[model samples]
Target chain A: MLRLPPFQYHRPSQVEEAVELLDRYPGDAMPVAGGTDLIPNMKHRLFTPGHLVALKGISHLHGIRVQGEELTIGACASLTSVAQSREVRTHFPALAEAAGQVAGPQLRNAGTLGGNLCLDTRCTYYNQTEFWRRALGYCLKKDGTVCHVTRVGRKCVAAHSADTPPVLMTLGAQVELVGPSGSRVLPVREFFVADGVWNSRREPDEIVTRVRVPLQPKAFHGSEASGEVSTRVRTGYAKLRQRGAIDFPLLTVAVAVALAPDGTVTWVRGVVTGLGARPRELTGWEEIAVGEPLTPEVVEALAERAGQQCRPLENMIQDPGWRGAMVPVYVRRALGKAVKQGGGGSL
Target chain B: MAPTHRIVRLTVNGDTRTAGVPVHYTLLETLRYAMGLTGSKQGCDKGDCGACTVLLNGEPRLSCITPVWEAEGLDVVTVEGLAGPDGALHPLQDEFDLHGAAQCGFCTPGILCSAAGLLARNPRPTREEIREALSGNLCRCTGYTKIYEAVEAAAARLGSGDAERERGERKEGVS
Candidate 1:
């Protein structure tokens, strides 16, 4: 019977009111969208905010609409809704798959897209009961000064376990937020910092309003010919967890590749998470993939380079070596899924 | 500062109820302690376990992580609401008994809510759909074979009523 510490709850019908409520109690108040992640962390005593500004009552923050060349998802839109959305499923299938595969059906029904994107980084030593954490003297992510994972590094290395952020990174999404000062938008990749503790760049008083994703990813090499090029774009996501359901991913891979009519790759990107604080967008993928047909051999080389760049740590319970080994495997699988979905597999 | 506690008004199991509770109390806690709806069990007070599942606006939601205030003016159907007004057991419940779906019966209530929500949306669901719907609700004792069997039987029994209703509508249209 773990009990939440007592707090004042404020339900604001408008974004302005919600941000004001949070601003009034800066550092003592937190904005809660779905509470799926925050409540558990609160019960674990990781955060004991004196006030919770409820964002569910804000009407404007609850729909998924398309605004000409981009899809806008309100922050309060439930993950279940996002996963089942026809528009999201058709355009950004990887985002839908990631959202649908979070925790379980019930949690998805309660969790929100903004909440998932703002999910607290998780680690084996951090997500524990107060009594258990006390026995271990706590960790760097919470109240303690020392990091149990690295045991030496000054930086906290908690793993980012959220499913959608990596996929959103691949999609080139942007997050909209309203704070006491004003509203601002940030690229989803730039939204997260390297630090695991309070990972996102969102201020304490800011309320995430919506997320905007371009219908078509911008050209990586910026070499688009005029009208009749007949470009085909595809994306895919792969996740590794202990169970088929209700488990946070040990390793997640998301890839998006665009090809010209001749099967020559124009733009390609891959992002992997559950490794460190921020989702790591795989570098050197463009070198292997761009300007060439995404043949099986090329995909294998891209995956191999990803394997060399990623190094899984002891932040999670699984063996780091096993997780590292699976990175290339999952990356290759994701590439295969994307190629198949695009109807352009050269395998 | 906002009020720490307030009276929350909501409809539960076809009855309108109001209770004064602390603002931080989760829907699971308010339902069990203040409203006396203990049928919705609280396992893994976080969202991991589906023991506190309830139908909110006819959709299965995790009440354990949901704030009580968010349930305001919404229809909440718990396991206690599964039985008919005449106190007849739901077909799902009867099937659970006919099949051995309940060993300890700890996870039955949440499973029932999830299955009920699934049936409301889809009268006839495939085994894969059933498995996906109940994936959140864990039953360690049953190993899920008997539970799946029970849901399948219940869906069949309920599907006949749906057929009758459709026929009645069609006949009315003809008239």
Candidate 2:
């Protein structure tokens, strides 16, 4: 019986008009693309915007377009479309898999790609109803000062619960932001912040318009235009959760690797999310993986190194210790699967 | 003063109608309260529960979280609309009844809409596809074994015909 607080709603037929409305309302309004996540959060009293600018009405803000070597996906494109898109599945299966894995069918149909990327950081303490949060004395994420995760820390440590950002981070995607001043494109990695309070760096008056990802090579062999190449860029994703469906990941791993024709890992990027305020690209993998072929030993060693760098606090479902301990295992399996593209995951 | 409300028009069960709804009223509230399409249940007001599922332009979407204003110019189909003009049961509904797929029947409406969405796109879905399609719709009863069987049986009966194809009779002809 939780109902949304009353708010003035505006529907703009164009992205420009939407940006103008956002600029007009600034601090008093919030843009809603699909309302999949925001509506629930609003019901929980997480955000109480006096005005809501609906983004789904904009016709231009809804499709997948290929411009040269890049693929631009509108912010309002539904996750179901993104998941089922043959173009996305063909060039970037990880994005499709991540989109498909979000919640379930009904949600996927309503949730949008931009909303998923800009999903609010979720925490057991912060996501509760206002009455529940009130009883707990409120946390830094909302009305209070102290953080429940790290009692001494002043910042919110709510986990970044979005699935697409981690995979998009690994894919090196860029997000396009439109505001009253103008529009600018930034790397997806730069779009997120380490603090949960202002999880995404998107300014209050700015709305994310689309995400542009340079199309990746179909294989590790060479140019995408050079068709019929047998080699392919190996990619894989692994998410550990409590259920087979409808549960957010305790830990998510996405890995992409391009092999040297000889089978040595040439270029590799790995990211692990759902652990902290932001999805982090694991460093030090190149130190061990660059020249060496991905044997079991190399993959295992790299996974251990990557796991050491991840700073997972006590957050999300289940015990934090168990969740933190799973980082390396999932990473190892993800990389192993990436090494064997056509083959099933190792483990 | 009374809150400002919009005169919203929506196409429900192939009929276009208008209603004065507050901007904040979700499609669920409008459907259950104003239009009286109570078949779409209100399990979880959030998108977590699929009880408020309905077809927005033939795609299953969470009506609870969807604003009533967004349904303007969109085709909406509810479980009540699943029956034929002569009131014949949808194959999926008949199968659900045959296999006792519904226990308490709280989650059946949403599950049915989600299954209809799946059968529309993919005629003969595998067991895994059926499970994936129903992932958003949660059922506390039946452990999903009976529901899966029911969807499978419905798909068998609906082979190659339009998933939206209603049985019995249709003057305008069914999809």
Candidate 3:
């Protein structure tokens, strides 16, 4: 049995109290939401906080609501709830599908949206038993000073393995966080940093309150036969992993496209993860997709460019060459899915 | 400094119970070690394996990763709670026995808990729904054919109220 190191547990009914508790302990305290990811890492001896401020007790952090044109999801909302939410499934199907695909049934029931977004970056060299990591003299992300992935650089290249952040970025979501300094909001795209040692920009004492995403149009349509056009927003997400269930993503692609009434692309954005410390929005997509209609040929061109720009590293367990080879295929598929979402989930 | 332990109280299998547990001990450890409710097995201490699955507030959750204090004040139903108070097997359990669905029986407890949860929400689930519900629980034996068949039969029996009739019949015979 891998026993968790002892810690004092504090259940705070209010978000302010939780932040104060964490601020008092500084580096010695950590806020735990679902404990799905943190518990396993603690068992591996990755972290040993003296205090764990439980966030589930906070009443204000547990609902899904729509405020005007935006949808707000409490940080403490369970992943299963997020996946099954009628509002989420209707307006933001990509987010729901990604949340539903995380891990398995039991985990989705326990894990939360904030926890998934704040998931720790993963690496093959790390995430091992204390005994196993000890045998290798440790790595740069932990006790030792060397990075086994590069075998030379001091920077850690652990891959970001979460599925929802990439999709959230495509939706232009904003993250709400409360800390000792008071509350602040930032775009989800800016929440993460490139450094893998500790990827997110969240402060040590910060508590993620909720995520707010502007609602998207329900449909997008273009008919070459009738020469009819309609303006809409469409998004799609696709993930590559070892299994259909209970496996972290090896590669994930998310895309969102807005079309003009004339059937020409107004704007397009694409993000891919499971390659580096931060999920990256592919550059030069606007150049290729802005003026042209999202025909199969145009989609293939955008995919080919993305393939050339993405260089996979040996951060995840899969072969970098294979993962790199899969980038274009997954990206193309994701774009194709987005183009077909003119009606709804069935599309 | 000494470790902090709390006196946690919770309802398990329709009974209220209390115990002093360390803050770090998981619900799985507290259930099996402290309370001696060993029906919930601990296969992978982490969330990967479904051997430690149990129902918290009527939803299936991984007990191995859940903190013991988190289950406080919530109704917890383990595999032992699946049968009636009089020891009449649940339709799922009776079917498993009749069909020889359990092989090695290691994963049976978790599978039963998950199946019970599915039936509670969705009385008549299709085979695809059954497969999706049990995806977390890994059954190495029987290739899942017997398990699927048993769950289907249990659903049919439950829908028909056959198990209730059998229980009433047995009570009358005993009297």
Clashing residue pairs for model 1: none
User: How far out, in Å, is residue A75 in model 1?
Assistant: 1.1
Q: Quick one: best DockQ, which candidate?
A: 3
**Window of ten residues with lowest summed lDDT in model 1 chain B:** B162-171
Q: What is the DockQ of candidate 1?
A: 0.60
User: Can you write out model 2's per-residue Cα lDDT over A250-281, one digit (the tens) per residue?
Assistant: 88999887665667666678899998899988
Over 4 Å off, model 2: A216-232, A342-347, B1-3, B160-175
* DockQ of all predictions against the true structure, Cα-based: 0.60, 0.59, 0.68
Mind listing the fnat for each candidate?
A: 0.75, 0.79, 0.72
Give the runs in model 3 whose Cα sits over 4 Å from its true position: A216-230, A343-347, B1-3, B165-175
> Comparing to the true complex, what docking class would candidate 1 get?
medium
> Higher-DockQ candidate among 1 and 3?
3
Isolated chain A: TM-score per model?
Answer: 0.96, 0.93, 0.94
Better of 2 and 3 by TM-score: 3
| Tens-digit lDDT string for candidate 3 (A2-95) | 8999989889999999999999998999999999999999999898898899999898999998888789999999999999999898877888
Off by over 4 Å in 1: A219-229, A343-347, B1-4, B162-175
